[model samples]
Target: MTLSSNVIKQCALLSSLALFSLSSAMADDHTNKPVVEQLVDTLSTIAGPHPGIRKNHAKGIVVSGEFIPSPDAATVTNAVHFESPATPVTVRFSNTTGIPDIADNNPSSFPKGIAIRFHLQEDTYTDIVSISVSRFPVATPEDFLGLLNAVATSGPDAATPKPITQFLASHPAAKTFVETPKPAPVSFATQPFYGVNAFKFTNKDGEVRYGRYQIIPVNGQEYLTDEQRAAAGKDYLFEELPRRLQQSQVEFALGLQIADKDDALNDPTVVWPETRQIIKLGTISLDTVDDNGKQFAKQTMFNPLALTDGIEASDDPILLARPSAYAISFGRRISGQ
Candidate 1:
């Protein structure tokens, strides 16, 4: 079953109020260190130390692909990839959490991730980072840190209505996120990924629009039934992607969910109505698995803010802070910290 729209909106309101009340207090505590460092520290605290891999979404598989833009793609943005011929891409599919060896079917892996790197001319490139869920829990970097800290502090015998539970109580979106049932996908090729932040797209004509990304599998979204999930192996998702690629190329349609003038552009916690327009951008066809998928993923930093001409980052604080956070994680793994 899915949550009703009314419930989600109400929760978003409650979350906003709760966050507003706690903002001043949190401001004092987070000043001693950079928010990015705090972010890294909180994530490590929650997931424990796992050197040489991503701090989050550590278990992932990388694949090589090319993106073929739709003719109408140029109508939305003047971005090179949208107007040029087929562009080469490096795509990675990953599980949630920092445990590199987490089981494919683990509940913690519900919100699977996909990060795509669009290789443009002159060695420049852009990236899109997304997850299975359409909406994120918090809207700001500080709130995200608070969420992480709450989870990290909440332990077995911590207390009734633990820190995490109390934190979720005040944040409706986070509550909804935690309560949502996310089943395991039969294969990475069968799931859909949605962008968490909105971007401002400018066309050659200088017209601008705000939109979020949506990458849907050409095969459509398919999840394993309870019976199938129970019988699946620990490495099912990772193993299945390679086997599926050998059978045929894995394909997905890249789309943009255009927002109306009144839509909240900066807040990721708000889920736009389903009736909004979704503009088809292109098709992504992945054929080969990276020879050193793990090492390649560790070395690559898929920054959502690493955009090219014609695409600009919105004023979303979470969106703006991502590049710095990712840089810290990349540095740690690259230097073998």
Candidate 2:
């Protein structure tokens, strides 16, 4: 069934209510903040305050590029970026959290982010926001917020049985997310980024397929050794990317990991099996790092839900909540709040 945008929004609201109900029952005096507000607040607590900026993924470098579609791209989807002559693109590579100067080797910097804006016709655009991790820690927005709350409440001086430890005990996927090795990348261009949420793609024949986006670096993956990590500069990624670009363009192939009939469509925390077929859609060629591109990236807000025809959001609550949360971040940043 074709899911409408309104249906996705309602699902997100319902998920929020479910989360609030469960958490409120556990606590005597739970704050009645909106889901978006709670998300911002919890992330702010974890990442510390960064006024007039994103609560997470605040540190980034923007670059300009082009998206060259593969010949068979149209057979899988009719997304505008895959149709043609090369389309201009703007992208941001960011570290996790609000600390703009977090060390490149910090474990907190795992699941690095890549946000892409495909400049389509008529000044319209589509965004694909992804992270280095294949799976997310929580399946729903409620669980995500709960995890953050657990972290916030379980500080160094908290009572016996820390909240985070309790949280991890209950959420195995979250525990796995924490336990997973997230090695520092040699460069942003070398890391494989995955869209943890699934999206529906429609082809010219009107056939719909549910899949996750996997952006594979054309240059192959490379990671820093333990010794290299120990001696790396705090801003190593930011410093390395531009120098790498000066030598040659950075590129990655945009591929979709097609979901099986029995795959969990609504859970971002569950990764689809690698046995599924992958369809290469296009190539992202990042050629230049300029002040203009940087300014544009800073001003632009990339939303995964900002989709065009033939491309639609799945029922994933995390995916549904993103647009609203992004709007809040964008508004705060632009207004200098």
Instruction: Give per-model CA RMSD.
Output: 9.4, 5.8
Once fitted onto the true fold, the runs of candidate 1 whose alpha carbons sit more than 4 angstroms away are: 1-27
Q: Write the per-residue lDDT of candidate 2 for residues 1-337, one digit (tens) a residue.
A: 1124323443444444445333432211476656666776788888877777777888889988899999878988887778877999888999888787787778887789999988888756788999998999998777888899998999889997999999999999999999878888999999999999999999999999999999999989999999998899999999999999999999999999999999999998898888999999989999888676444544666778778888998988888777666665665665665
lDDT of each residue in 1-337, candidate 1, tens digit only: 0124323432443344333333323334526666666787788777788888788898899999899999989999999999989999999999988888889988877699999989888766788999999988898887888898888888897988899989999999889888767888889999999997999999999999999999999988899999999889989999999999999999999999999999999999988998999999999999999897776676577878778999999998888777766666666776676
Assess the local accuracy of residue 313 in candidate 1 as a C-alpha lDDT between 0 and 100.
Answer: 92
lDDT of each: 0.84, 0.82
TM-score of each: 0.91, 0.90
How many pairs in model 2 have backbone atoms within 3 A of each other, for residues 3 or more apart or on separate chains, i.e. clashes?
A: 0
- Number of clashing pairs per prediction, in order: 0, 0
**Looking at candidate 2, what is the lDDT of residue 16?**
49
Cand. 1 TM to true fold: 0.91
Give the C-alpha miss distance for residue 60 in model 1, angstroms: 0.4
